[model samples]
Target: MSLGGETAKATIAKFAMAAVGFFGSILFARELGPKAFGGYYLLFSVTKLADRPLMGWATASKKQFADNETKRRELVGAQFLFNAVWILIATAIGLLLADRFRSYSGIAMAPFLFVVLLVSESNYEAFDRVLTASGRVGLSTWTDALRSYLTLPLQVFFVFVLTGYAADGMVYGLVGATVFTFPVIFYYIGTRPAVPSVDTFFSLAQYARYSIPTDFFATLYNRLDVILLGMLLLPAAAANYEIAAQLTAPATFVATLAGSGLMPRVSRLRAEGKTVGQEVTNTIAFSSIFAVPIFFGALAIPRALVVTVYGPEYTLGVSLLAGIADTVYFRRRQRH
Candidate 1:
């Protein structure tokens, strides 16, 4: 399959993930009382933010990974190592600060931490990275499909049927789902593992370091709201906000897919000593044009969506999310 074609398939897979996320958001709101939901959302958002330490390494990593097997192994292995470290540190800090945290769910913190640190799920990006770099487009798409579509239904089942406690059940489902990605990533790496020769380790670290700050800031912008909400509002209030955000997930997948696909291609052009002007243009214009509608439409009728999906109890934060959607759609993402 062609690069764009493969990327399109990956985008479809991401939409499936987005569907899971979209539905998962509603399921959690229903299963947990708003308060518990709030706590869970806040925590999940923070844990997600911690993942930013890897920065956009997935994108840059793909660049190096596209070049050589040894380089790929070292880059991926080091990134995996770094992701583990950051996830652990963040989870520990979350635990240590629990009592002080207004958004603490009564649920056990360790399980969520385990999910955050899961090797299989956490390294999922590596699969697409390897596939994109290797030009194995269609296979790359399948892996994402496996992760998203396959895992989503199971998650819904857990949330709606098995446990019915959104926070716990959703986490259980998500953790279970992540197991599917590990095999795909390993397989993508093929026989020649990205083993870190000492040189490669340094290469990995340097690359990771360069990408960390931009991702950190970008991630913080995404999750910082949840953290602040945990501090400022009650959990249910936070959850209500989360509900509005949930509606945003599916559509945002388009931007994500665009950005992800654009990166590897841009890297290839650079490799061929080509200017990446069009690549950057396509990524930006498309991301902006794509993200604008979903974001604004949600803002236009946030309360209706929230109330319809999660029940009337979720009405309070609709306006806030609506405002946020409007602000961010036009303001924050126009540049990149």
Candidate 2:
């Protein structure tokens, strides 16, 4: 598909996912209240940090898969092996450190649930990257949408309908959604793993050498604040901060979606010996159109938007919205 077509589908999928996520966040916040929700967010942030180590492999896989069609299956096999080993090692370490994680996050299920979350998140990310790298951008977007849509109802059932799960219910729902969606993702990708050669491992590792540090610092930059808040302050503070961050997330979607579609296109264009200067310029220009307005809009109504969307219980985060919005805007610009 053309970049425009892929971007349009991604935009639509993002709209749907954002709408679902907006409602779901409200429900989760109201239902669990600030303290519980904060703990959940903290646990999630920790898992995101844990997952970062594997991100280099996923990043390398995307570039390699896009550029080297002949080696796609071997790349897939290598990535799968690498991810499996990482998950096993990470999960074991997490289980061994369960007590510390539990004490810090104040979530009783942190130890057990963290492993499930890590596995699910790792696999889902790998599958999504494969789809995008293979130029199934629209399909990949819908696949993500599928997971988001599935997660909400399951979360509602686990958190609201069932008894005693509480914030842990959110984790359960997410894992369930991932389990249900994997087969669909597998079917679409349609490539069985081949035996990866020694060179496949070397190539992936060489690329990951650069990608790992980039992924590591980026994940830390994004999640470190939440992690620090969870450690140093009340869970409610972390919860409030997370709510503000979530509310401002949409501001960067245009740039994020553009980049998603741009990468594969650029890879192909470069392979074809075509100049991509105009394409990059046009994408950056197009992204600024929405990002700038969202930044200002957030600045204009930070207080009202917070109390209205997330309830007065979250009013403490009102001061945070504009700053987060500005960060989102700058991050989008920096990304381009």
Candidate 3:
């Protein structure tokens, strides 16, 4: 498919995922209320922070897979090994710090749930990068949409139908959805594990050396605020900040779409000795068109938007939405 077609499909999938996530967030916030939802968000943020290290390898694998098709199976095997080791180490660290995490997050099962979520999320990230790297950008995005759509009903079932699970139910629902989708992702990639080559490890390491620190700081920059609020203040405070952040999150969609679709295309073109100057230029122009309006629109109606969508209880951080929207707009520009 042409780049335009691939991006259009990806955009549709992302829109669906965003719509589902937006409504799901509102439902969880209203049903769980501020405190429980905040606790869940706090744990969610922690998993994001913990998963940063894997992102380096995931990003590198995407680039490597796109650049060297002959080594695809080797890259997959090496990444699988790396992820397995990382999960074990991360789980051990979480266990060691279990008590501290519980006290800080104010959730008794935070550490245990963290381990489950960390593993599931890491698996999803790995698979997502692999699919995108292989140039199935639309399929990659559809998998994400499937996960989002599946997660909401499962969360509702666990939280309400099962009774008493609350925030923990949300975690279970997320993990279950991810696990359920693995077979589809696996079938698309269709590579059985080969013996990992030593050369492939070094090749991945070379790319990851630069990507790792970039992923780490990016994760920290994006998530540190919520982490701090959850730790320093109450979960409700963190929830307020999260509400503002979520409301402004869609501003970055254009940039994300450009990045996701362009990277593999650019890498492949470079591998074929083709210049990508025009592609990059076109993406920048396209992103700017949508970004400016979204930024201003959010600034204009922060309070009413929040109240109507998430209800009045989430109005505490209405003032922060404009600033957060601006931050998201600039961040997207910087990334693009």
Model 3 residue 238 lDDT score? 83
Residues 1-336 of candidate 2 have per-residue lDDT tens digits of 677677778878888999999899999998888988998889888888888768778888888888888998898888789989999999999999999888877888899989999999888877677778876777888888999999999999999899689889999999999999987887887778888999999999998999888888988998888998987887888999989988877776666777876877788889989998877886787677667887898889899888988889999899988888898888777776
Instruction: Please report, in order, the local distance difference test score of every candidate based on alpha carbons.
Output: 0.64, 0.85, 0.84
lDDT of 2 at 53: 66
| Candidate that would win on lDDT | 2
Q: Candidate 2: where are CA atoms >4 Å away?
A: none
What order do you get sorting by lDDT, best first? 2, 3, 1
- Angstrom error of the Cα, residue 84, model 2: value is 1.0
lDDT of 3 by residue, 83-141 (tens): 89989999999999999888777789999999999999988888688888767888988
Cα-lDDT of candidate 3? 0.84
Clash pairs, model 3 backbone: none
Higher-scoring candidate on TM-score, 1 or 2: 2
What would the per-residue lDDT of candidate 1 be over residues 1-336, giving only the tens digit for each residue?
244565567666666667666766666677667876776666566656656655456655676776665466567666666666766776677667755543254455534443454444446654456556666655666666676666667767876777655566666666666676767667766744444577876665677677767777877877777777777756676787777776665556545655666666766778779888866665565565446777868757777777787888888767777766775676536656
Give the TM-score comparing model 1 with the true structure, all chains together.
0.83
Report backbone clashes per prediction.
4, 0, 0
RMSD of each: 3.3, 1.4, 1.5
